[model samples]
Target: MKEIVKFSFISILFILGINIVSFSQSPNESSLGIQIEKNPEFRDVELYELKITQVFKIGNQGKDSIVLKAPTTMQIQSPQLGLKIDTIIGVSRYKVAQNQLIIYFSKDKIYDFEIFYSYFGNVANLNLIGGNLGSFYYWDANEEFWYFRSTNTKINEISISYPNNFYLLESFSNSKDIISEGTNKETFISRSIQNIPLQFILLNKLKYERKRVVKSNQYLYIYLPIDSTRNLYLNKNNIVKKIESQFDKVICFFDEVTSRNIDVIQIDYNKKGRALGNQIICDSSFFYTHHLLHEFIHVYSEIRTVKNDSGYFFLEESLTEFLAICLNYNSKNRDIYFDRKIAYYSNKSHANKSIFEVDKNSNENWDLIYGKTPFIIHLLSLRLNENEIYRILKDFYIHYSKKEVTFDDFSLFLRNQSVDKEVFSEFIRLL
Candidate 1:
């Protein structure tokens, strides 16, 4: 009897130990948000899969129940898009669609799971400032709801393998020139530019001028789309030539931002001042001659960074803004773009700090990463040589591409090149 009791106790302890090892402290503990981990292997232009098990720490401040709630449905969506894959699942495993799944963990527990499928279009993150992940209610959990800034985003087609009836009927613009159609049937694709694979259609028909701006090494890349009808044309040959000239391999991607991901440029007109930087989805009412030059420099330099839907908010837009201000401000491509005002509203910290400064506190607020970072870069340009500045910027992009370069990457690049690190460091310190 004594031996049996001891054996039972040992077994219980062993099981408990296994459970503890299965999970670590949730990263979402402080914020109660989520983090998406990319799949280890690349499946063509497949975007990173969010391992739902990859624990996303929920923010403690907002609706605390985000952790406790067993969500009945999840919709990956935007205001322009009603496209979603919503299903209800609890403790049981759910093989809802072809490539997606839902598995359950214990309370305050997390694990990694995957939904694998080919992408129909783009996958973008919805930004809900001051919103907590827990605020998104799962009808089952009775959680409070929080609002998000639903800009024009890339919505993927999950049911392509399903019957054609499941897929959204695509519509295109009647006039190839009409860029936007004020919330038409299709979310991202122009209404008139219809009946074709959007990636192929966008790649083939898109044509925009390089806007005769001379490159002096340092430059900015801005994609500006005008009107609610976001149609920007690109002559395939020009695109091929320019892209081939810069990158060793060129690919036209409809969704996902890795090495060669490009999206329809969207910029704001005179009115609202919410999400800033180059609007990736909507068309800008006014086009800047220098905008092409700035964007060209990013591709030309082969700034081989893995930018996602939010990368523009995090790095690309701020860097592009900084580079554009420095290059366009001095170049002949200058034009009145009062409509495309700079507000680093998308990712605020970068708007205020050094271009490479990683946000120490993920939950902090920022409104200037777009506007202010450029001024700092411009200031740096004043002290550094245009050629040196250009080389530095290019090197920064290339070196960072080798790995994720933080603000420290800039410091490391300077040291590795044996350039006087102080030249740029002093500028950063001053800022």
Candidate 2:
């Protein structure tokens, strides 16, 4: 009996030690898992579907709950598992707002739970444009890229697979991460998808054949949109020649300040807009005239490391507008354009807010942000002389390219150049 008691006590102690080790290894840690696959059934242009799954581990030692939410515009599928807290397991409660889905769950005492949903349309992270050339998505060469991000959970790994028929065009990731098995192309990202941009391009050969490309180094390339229509504004050949010839002039204008090559995609879409980056997606009719020059200058400033802070729009948009006008205006009547803009800005009814006071929250604030402020920059240019102003812009680009800068920092930069404080101050007073 005594020997038996001693053996029993030893076994109890060993089991207790194992329990302690297990407890120590377990902590209140959470992760997010994601998988995106192309949908085959959808035939429309908006056929892509995304599956987002969020997992939360409620640490056994804690009571903090996890919240999962999505933009209200998304159509989330019903979650599979009901809420299980402690010994009690039941349905979890959630609410949907105009463009949001708010879900609450305990991550500490409840242990672990997963909530998932599917949404239609192309990935919001990718600006996808579809034409006769099929669907094209652009990735900025400069910044990091990610799909949806979680506020509280850390994304550990994301496995993304393209459509089985799609071919990989470009990928800047490690070769090991990208695997080609059978007809599908797969990439596994162990790195945090948060803000880490992927330099990649995937083409769906089943949708459209490869279009012609004019390569100007890795950064600069011109892609002609595939179109069978030789008439209307979507004329492929004429538009290509027009953009090529005009963009060549733009290259000469900012040649010294930027070596970053430009990628001009001749899209047939009827939109008259441009996104600021290494990529410029434009309608066939959009040339490298004043409109593009202005926008591209904005792009140049963006590629530079400027301190991004409030009130920097004066230096950013305004300066770009000023330069575009200066470069693209016919020498004979450039002043007419400047005077007309200044007069139009001066006549604005919403003069209650100064240019500096106009935050993004301001309603109908375009006149001040885009009009008055740029005219103010033009006014300052006149006082500082065109050469001095151009020097300031060039120097600003050289010193602060690809960096963050604020308005005060920009002001100090001008001051250091011995610009007249009174003149600069006058411009500030108007703003």
Clash totals for all models, in order?
A: 46, 21
Question: Which ranges in model 1 have alpha carbons more than 4 Å from their true place?
Answer: 1-279, 289-316, 327-367
List, residue by residue over 1-431, the lDDT tens digit for candidate 2.
00101111100000000011111223333333323355566555333443433344344434333344443333333232112111112227555443344545454444544433333333333444443455544555444333323354444433444565554444333323444445554534444233334444444464433333332421445555343456756555565566555555455555644234455655445545564344565654556346666656665554332434566556666666667776666534566876777777677688556756555634488777767777778778788877787788777767776677778777888889888989979977877
Candidate 2 structure, TM-score to reference: 0.59
lDDT by candidate, in order shown: 0.31, 0.50
For residue 241, model 2's alpha carbon misses the true position, in angstroms, by: 4.5
Candidate maximizing lDDT: 2
Cα lDDT of model 1 by residue, 1-431, tens digit: 00101111100000000111122343332111111222346554222222111112222323212222211232333332212334332233433322223334444543232222221122222221111100010111112211111121111111111111111111212223332223222222222332222221111012122222112322222232211232344333443334333222211111114322233332232321211211122223212333443443443333444433233333555566556554545432222221144332334434444434544313342334544455555556656666677677655665555354444445566667655667657765654
